[model samples]
Target: MSERTTFQDQPHRTVLLRNGTVHSPADPFATAMVVENGHIAWVGSEGAADSFADGVDEVVNLEGALVTPAFTDAHVHTTATGLALTGLDLTGVRTLADALERVRAYAAARPADRVLLGHGWDASTWPEQRPPSRRELDEATGGRALYLTRADVHSAVVTTALLDLVPRAREISGYAADAPLTGPAHHAVRAAAYDSVTPAQRAEAQRAALARAASLGIGSLHECAGPEISSADDLTALLALAAQEAGPRVTGYWAEAITSVEGAARVRELGAIGAAGDLFVDGSLGSHTAWLCEPYADLADGAGQRGVCHLDAGAIAAHVIACTEAGIQAGFHAIGDAALSAVVEGVRTAADKLGLARVRAARHRVEHAEMLSPELIAAFAELALTASVQPAFDAAWGGDDAMYARRLGPERARTLNPYAALLRAGVPLALGSDSPVTPLDPWGTVRAAAFHRTPEHRVSVRAAFTAHTRGGWRAIGRDDAGVLVPGAPADYALWRTGDLVVQVPDTRVANWSTDPRSGTPGLPELTPGGPLPLCLRTVVGGHTVYAGPNE
Candidate 1:
């Protein structure tokens, strides 16, 4: 295997890809595309491709493959995802004992690690229904400092030794002697753990993550980094690596609250696109920290134990106004109803003060957005707020017997992730994996949304596909990318697929869309149990980032 050349090294390449099914709005039945100088110069039928056949520098015979715009994961934690890929992953450990054993073995295997870091443990499914205790973790790792985060990344169970690294963590609001830490405590411990990672290790993890994404046909990624989630140096390093490599394009969002133009400028200095991403308005439901209108059915702590609220409506309003004035996108991580309500109130106040058009023009986004009301859905459309969502969340924790139903009652759980409502109400949707929380499976994500556990919330596969692709580009205020149209950036993937067909949740619409006269460019069959298309090649800005198997 030879080292792959990056787009930066081959800036002016001209290539023609022919004999493939091209999914383009410009030509629904197209089977060819021409790329020149990192942009789509032309896209049409096989006959039209003949004119450019003798003129291109290189010609790729796609051999009847399916070509579509490469996917854009709207929200991701790059370094964390990489670490999970290269380190201990407790994603499906059903027993508490198994999780502990995995931790013990992992610790023994990596004896020289400064701070042991791992993710994706959900105690909700454990028979004991509890996370490993600090003492248990101490014994598991022989008192080694360890930070193991929950699947949601909102909380963690840290060894006492790790807590000693951050002495003030004990004073944080959500800290407890034995229970998993939340809020400031979790953030503090996570920082200490990640800070222990050397620059070389971090770079290797990031490269592994980008390579995995490229192989999965992901052409762009929205890095959701923050002071609490990840450090500024981490984001800078990842961005530099992406810029210097041939992998997916990475757009970084630094989740910091801004109250002045100076703060916004400082965010720009960090090489971030906006002061947005995982700006926590609240926490996650699994951690029992998401701000809710009502108390959790499972917790009997008190009458008013309805999750935690990190930011009030006033603080949210201040940030929105500041970001809007500075011409930067602002976003919040709001899951529960109360947190979402605060976001709506704050954005509405900003709209009132800055004029609706000015505020809406900023196109600020909200992450997760799982627990939404009809009113909130309307508010998102009115304010032009992009709902950066993860359908995998629904697939993982939804249904009557899952974690969501255990947290909130089954009825309320069914209402979570209202994709159909959001789409019908005209809210712009950008799909993501929130990788490490859920694995990055683009076709699986589309299937999850189309075949939602709660049927009423289901969206068409085409709609979900668009949300994962072009919607991500639109979220970052780019309209010229993430599509197969001429003049668009040449970021696309070639997939060895079965047959292209229209798949929709609604039978009436499915009947119409499947008809040839509808002119809808078909996608692969995304039935729940069906196999997804395999990527043959992935190109970013006209350069091949990944060529699978023998390609």
Candidate 2:
């Protein structure tokens, strides 16, 4: 029998922290803090710490480190993120030959009979700018069941052996020779590959991913699991782990478009916040499956073929209504303009059916609404949706000469992921890495938003940081959790920072100047091209889940 992992209950005690710059909402430069009963008890300058420390159970000197609330990754695939770390990682293969060589090396290293699973291959960055053909992958893997997903997770390249094993794959749509499998075919083949992995392996992968999140100073992560991304059993195991551990908290999102009474009942039993996130309204742009306003500029085979739209207005409206009535958040994975348009109409329909106040109070969410028309943006604001976004998308494939430009033409490409516009419209924004798709780099994500390629859409550093930290808590209706003031949850990170500088958009795109009037203190310098802070410790609910050398 597999042993069940159980977390020991922790008894709270008073602990005093001193000689550090506290990045609290109340006081940014506070040199002392007191945590007790699993919550922040006091925060002040060092002058008043001695009195508070007099009877505390323990006293810790922070040694001048920076203290702030630990990050909340608004969207993540837990098992997949962890598996990527332990599996063949092809994050930055610069040439086609390099990719082929890596595949060859990886396949040789694995057991002869074991199926090979890998992710993070973007042909756009390579010199050839193309993925390998099925025959090439079959030659590389020697007929083993091999599946290498694209960087966007929207499509994948699989060996013929794998396709033969998945007999249904041949009957599914979106199957093309020498091209990545997308739409239904991609989903089927991908499922078959992962289905071979044992439950123990899945558990281990989740544990590995959660450990990484803790080490990265993340205190909470929303598991965006669904019928498409993962099974109900996977979500259960993950939520169980988070509840029992002294680690990053997990808020679950089961992505499914509710179609029937049975489906609504199943969603409530999934042990998640809502049936939202990655319940695909559309596919990703990288795979040419994202529901776009017009035909992709690079489309060669299918003349005038726009991307796929999985859900129409009626389906979206039905899902939204069911979720709203159930008192759970409703969201969709929308990247392109057509998808966002569908989502907006759905939300509007739900509001009309179930009073706008009821819908707004539910605080429904939408993931990766990357392309939005002004009308759609206004609708999102009116519906009060949380835009769960990944800044690294723009950082990696957002430049004029990058993949997005090639896919949608330069003018249209530059219009995607309008962070400032969304924020200015009073829509709540939650930033995340989307894990294997980007990476679990919170500071890197912050930098990307502040230094967007299009200067006009860049947000202030504080706003970007707030969106990442506080916006995540707000995403799932946890308004009291993200901030670090007295009476808040004792969840935070300690960092070893360097010369602190603030960035502002100016005449030269980035002025790299600190503003005295801003009243913010000592954030890591976020120039267009700059370094990020290294986290030394991470604390969740007054418990240290990760401690670096200093402890």
Candidate 3:
């Protein structure tokens, strides 16, 4: 067998890439590129690249491929994603029995004492419209500890044994002994449920997730971690691993609600980029935990249950101000009108207290700005707030009859995820999968935004792609990435184009582009509901992270 090579074994090597259709408006005919000293040194025609390769350590033939800046997922839970990859994958489980059967099989395969950690359980789609009960889990596991997070990760069904570990869960407002714990109760039990996942397990899972990401042409991820979501050690370990390995780059954001300078110092000490990303202002719409101005249309009890507001406006303002004064970003997870309203008010308060320029310069962000009124959208634009959005949420549940419509009324549902409105309002939109909630597919995300359920809310394919690529970098306060240029970081992906079709902003049907003379070139036909480009290789900072099956 051939010996495997890593960047550590071969450092400071120059790579010459040629015979590729580079995606750059600056130089249309740029078919070759040079990566020297871990950065893009030159980009031009193949004829010019040969001369530059004279003193290079390696010359890579592109074999007539397409190259563009590698993708970056703005919001991701690395450990959760990795665990889902390696643990019980409950995605697409049609019936409750199927889910139980899978869990039973998974448990049998692994050690009995090992805590069963599984994700992606959506009862709404199940035949029974109900998840496996605690009794069912206990029966399946023979009293083993098991915890499965709902698709939204806002609720989870835990085995009695695991619930025993977090006795205080019963005191939580949304707690139930046999039912799926949601809101604060879910948060309380989650840590106890994941007690068995050691540092080694987390590292393994992180590697598994990053490897998959690299294979799919993703070069970076903004890890959304916090006290409620994930432990500080988990974030630190993942960051340390990324620094040491030739994997996708990871930027950490600690989402703990900051109330003191000591907390801010601790966040910095833990190597967090900011006190941002998933600092929950509210919960998810699917779980009915999203704080909304109006009560849910499908509420069985009454019209009183709007949702839960984990963080009040005062808390939001305090955290924002703290992060701003410390020259860091402060973000929150908001998905409803009420939560968005509070966020806007908090942002306004922070801006008033701190200078507007300082607030804008901080470039704070909000995750899942799903339900935004025109006024709120305008507020975001005026504040220069970064809308860290997930298109897959709309894709999975945004149609008139989908989950959003079912939860809220059709009229209210129609108002969700107004991608075009946000874009028109000049709100900086950053597209992410929020994976394990949604699968990590950039093309899917872009497609979802372009082909929005609400036709009027659809954004241009170009705009959606930009949001996924460029907006992601800006969300993390990194300007050196996202763009493909000599000065930009050497983070890009090579692909073999299946079909060439240029999708205009206004049109549904894509225009064909086979000839070089066609002013605009078609890199890959990401037509509505079509397969995305097949990645050939992914490169991050001049290091080969993933090579495709054929390569």
Candidate 4:
């Protein structure tokens, strides 16, 4: 571990990154850049370096790697993501048999005293659909197994023996009355199972997650969870993990679903410590519970489920108003068009009731505005809602004629990740990996945004970069991030590429790269393949927290 040292004690003080093209974003481009005390002091040509050579401490050669603002995933579940990183990953397991084999192997290696837990197995994506049961898990874990949760994190599969250990699991919220465990009841057991892990174990999981994020050059994240369901204790535990003397910086959005002014007050108190509050207006698309105008084309149970509206229209309006009045910004999770509409109404009603001028001043936002009618595009801008989207979602599943089309059909499928449309409509676009749901990689995220499955909706590489970097910071109401300008935070990522021309293009036009399947030279520059594209070095607030061996 590196010692915590002051800038004065460090060998490098006035460092010159000369000859490399600096994409200040504020300016068209600069030839070189100078970093002093962890902030950009000057950006110009290589000749500008000589003027400060007398005061120079160390000089670094760019070697032609693209230097840009480090990414910040605006919406992420840090603790869950961290645990997933260390647990038995069945994320890619196709069959129930495949999942069982992995669980059995994991259980074989564990001690009797240890309670086995794992994540990342989505039944929705599996060939043998519906979630597994306790009986199946019991067989998988031998006799002493406690396998919990698939990808959604909203549900889990626990062995009978494991459920016996936690007696309350026998009667959980979302579980079916006749069944041993199912639905929200199963989720409650999963949450309780998570709580069973000691603070020390939880902290370790968080540490592993932050380490991975640092390696990927993600400088910040928003931790979203329900209020009573996903308590402040969870956020505190995650913050404790990131609070290590050596770790990347982290900001949080505490997603509490409470609708009272008192609930808003508690969230406001959390904001004093840099945590934002999040609300869920609807369920996820995969679950087929997102409130939509029309029924899902695939599921013809009529309009399908209209989604879970936990609060009434008036209550929804009150919650937004309460959060804003308490001086805390709110984020609403609205995955379906109907949910999006409800959120829009809530924001508008809240604004109208509390004066639009003052409401805009609060900067409240709507998270995951994924599915929306064309008519609602302008409404998002009108309501001043920030679209907290996960670009990596499209990259993995939204390939041409893939799962999205299968789930949403053709017409609705076209709107999978409408980056360009939202941007043009003046909706503040922010990028998030929603880790656990998707891997957290900025380049892959940019690739997804810049090269959408549907070509027309694709955004420029610069525009995608902005969403992942600056737009993310703005999503959380901060301007200090995502820039290389003077007085900005000394946080940036360096990617070694063969030719910087493709990445740092002259014209601002969106350029579609060769297919990822093709062995194009450009792909290797961003994704060096081995060890997740080596972070090189990660500095937060002018202090180096992570330095790769390649550095």
Candidate 5:
């Protein structure tokens, strides 16, 4: 990996980039952009570029590349993402046997490590239709301490040797001897697993994850860290690294609920933007732990199994009220219908207590809001809450025969991730990868939203792109960045792409917008199986963070 060159360390220079398709609202047909002093100074056509050509310090011929605002992944686990990128990644493993074999190899290769850590194993896709048993894991790792999380990161299957690290794990809720751990049990084991990582390994992982983000044209990351999810030291270390480096900006959110001014102060002291991000209201659907209004279809004990609810309406209301009064953002991780409903009810209550306008101004967010009803969507709009969502979830587990249908049945599954409805209701939408849960593929995320499995839920490509870019900035209470317009922060990416065109999900509105006279800026073709754009360069605040092989 290359070292980042900070903007302050280098002398300021005016750069004129001409002969490229600049995606800017200032001029739809803009072919040139000027960057100076870490900000966009100008954007216009090639014909008008001659006026400032001689005055500029440097000029580059783009060779017809596409320049657009870089992406912001609204939700991520930085350290965990890095670990998955550099360590054993079972993201696409096809079978349980293959997973075991990989684990055996990884364990043998790293014999000096205190704990074996790996992520992205979805047993639902395996032929055996289950995760490896404790004994199977023991045999694979030669009775070593191993901790492997499922794809959702909401649950995990651990070897007995690792389980011993948390003596009370067996007595916690959502613990089963033969099954994967969930709830407090999962948190305990995950903490133990991460605690075993040395500081050097942790810093290396953070750097690796940020570098990967920059390579994919992601310029900002909203790290979802919490006491249960990750330690305060972890969040502080990641933030320090980002500040010292010229990579993507890292905004941390400590996911601990607060009910008092002092509680909010504690979160601010931790270097977090808010007491939000992954403040879990429930678990995940794949783990059968997402708090739902109805029982899971595949559960044998369906009558009582409605997943898990970590926080109630009262707690959510208190946290929101406190955060609002403290002038900080508050967010939650809610996936199932019951969990989303609780969020809505709690926010509504907070709005009632602290005037509606005051609450909305705080721009509180809700993460992974997949199962939303028409009423809930209305509430989100009324409260002006930003939906920090990962479209890749639907692409991975959606459809009639996928894991969603198996868990929630086809009917309820179709109701998940209603992006179009949310947009129609005027609710803000911010796209993300939720890395380790889903890989950091920005273009793939846009494609998934534009070409949703259930057609009714699909949004336009332009809408999806904006959600991944400007929407992320808006969610973090900034409206001046994440765009290529003059006066905006110089955070952008240059891409080697195919033909550029305006693509929409609705056929009725496509004809008018696709016409060149529409004045709409075009993005790279994002057809389901087609090639996505390749990032040639990623720049953050006028500093080049990632340069492709060609550059």
Candidate 6:
């Protein structure tokens, strides 16, 4: 295979993509697409492709590959994803010992002063049911520990060395009045770990992650750079990395608490407004920190702890008001029911206090309406709040008798995500991957949403596609993205199996592409036997940012 050329400047390059089945996500499903300088010039049958009568400069047959609007992950920590791509990965390990072993191996491979950064270790699922302590890692690293964080990013377990490097960590905040920096303070230590990384190293990590995302067909990502930890300079580093044109388009979001009038002004000065970054009303369920009305099912404490509310109602309302007053769009992380409710209340309070028209104009949003009651789902449309969620999370963990189920109990777990319910209730949906927590595989996300592992939450593939594409563009107020039609940005993904069909198996067994060692029926993984399907030849603004090797 020859290396594909990335055209930086268009020299009358009128390329015609013929015979491809296009999922324009528009009314049409299959049609020839014409590209002139990167934007779709026309979309119709070869007969109507005569619009290219100006004479095409180049012609390539799509060979019936699926040409769909490229996916936009509505929520992700791009810098974090990039770092994890090159650093240690502990995503699917079951025991704390297993996690420590991975970190120990990583530590052995590198020398001291070289900060050990890692992600994707979920303490909730581990039998230990708690994060690995700094002391445990201390032993693992031969007392030279500098391990940083778990997967949720909500917390971190740092060695004494790391704590010494970040003295502020000594004054950890956000826990009960008595406790030390063990909880959210660990998040601070994680921030310190990021500082240890050089700008060049961070950029390289970002580039590698973008390459991974491109290989999986993701063209754009919403980088949720939390302000509580990441300072303006951190965001600057990320933006500087993003400007490199290496892999995917990065849209950044700063944390809400830090989005002060001055901070909002700085972001505008930094040229980050009308883009990414927002506040968190609550934490995540994986951390058992999501603000919920009812408590965890298994917790012995009769009084279930409704999830954490990082921002008080007044602070949340005030911030929303401030962001709106400044004409900046905001996104809030709301996973649990109570947290979602609080954010909704905050938005409503902000609007009512500052006037609804003004708040509506700002279009400040709520991210991840993961566990919505029917009432809240209805309110999302009324409030015009954007439910930025990761569908793949549902397919992976929201299935029958899964962790989420055990946490929320059957009723609540079954209703988690509720895409069909939300859409039907008129909630505007936006899809994201929440990378490092989940894979940035756009097709897999679409597949999960389309084929709801629980079946009850299944949404049409078209709707899921729209949520991933158009919905994300709309969420960030990008009019040109998520559309392949003319006059829209020429951002799209070209895949090999656009029309591949899948049916629900009669047996309720997980499909593996390869035969399972368990020797169970229908247990072979559903692997595409042919060439890699859904390989991304992603193009943005007519520039070939990423192309599959097959090209």
lDDT of model 5 at position 201: 97
Candidate 1: tens digits of C-alpha lDDT, residues 1-551 = 23435455665679999998999999999999999988999999999999999999999999999999999999999999999999989999999999999999999999999999999999998999899999999999999999999999999999989999999999977799899999988888888999999999999899999999999999999999999999999998998899888899999999999999999998898889899999999999999999999889898867447998888999999999999999999999999999999999999999999999999999999999999999999999999999999999999999999999999999899999999999999999999999989998888999999989999999988999999999999999998888999899999999998878887798554332557787999999877787999998999988899999956
- TM for candidate 4 is 0.87
The local distance difference test score of each candidate is: 0.93, 0.86, 0.85, 0.67, 0.93, 0.70
- Estimated TM-score per prediction? 0.97, 0.96, 0.95, 0.87, 0.97, 0.87
Winner of 3 and 6 under lDDT: 3
Model 4 RMSD in Å is: 5.1
Q: After the best TM-score superposition of candidate 5, give how far the Cα of residue 11 lies from its true spot, in angstroms.
A: 3.8
C-alpha RMSD by candidate, in order: 2.8, 2.3, 3.5, 5.1, 2.5, 6.8
Consecutive 10-residue window with the lowest summed lDDT within model 5: 1-10
lDDT of 4 by residue, 4-46 (tens): 3433244436677765556675443565777887787777766
In model 2, pairs of residues that clash are: none
**TM-score, cand. 5:** 0.97
Q: Give candidate 4 misplaced runs (Cα > 4 Å).
A: 1-14, 112-114, 145-147, 165-173, 176-183, 228-230, 258-262, 271-278, 300-304, 399-401, 502-534
TM-score of model 3 (CA atoms)? 0.95
Instruction: Give the Å error, residue 526, model 3.
Output: 1.3
| lDDT, residue 279, model 4 | 61
Clashing pairs in 3: none
Question: Which parts of model 2 have CA positions greater than 4 angstroms off?
Answer: 1-8, 260-262, 300-304, 507-518
Q: List the residue pairs that clash in candidate 1.
A: none
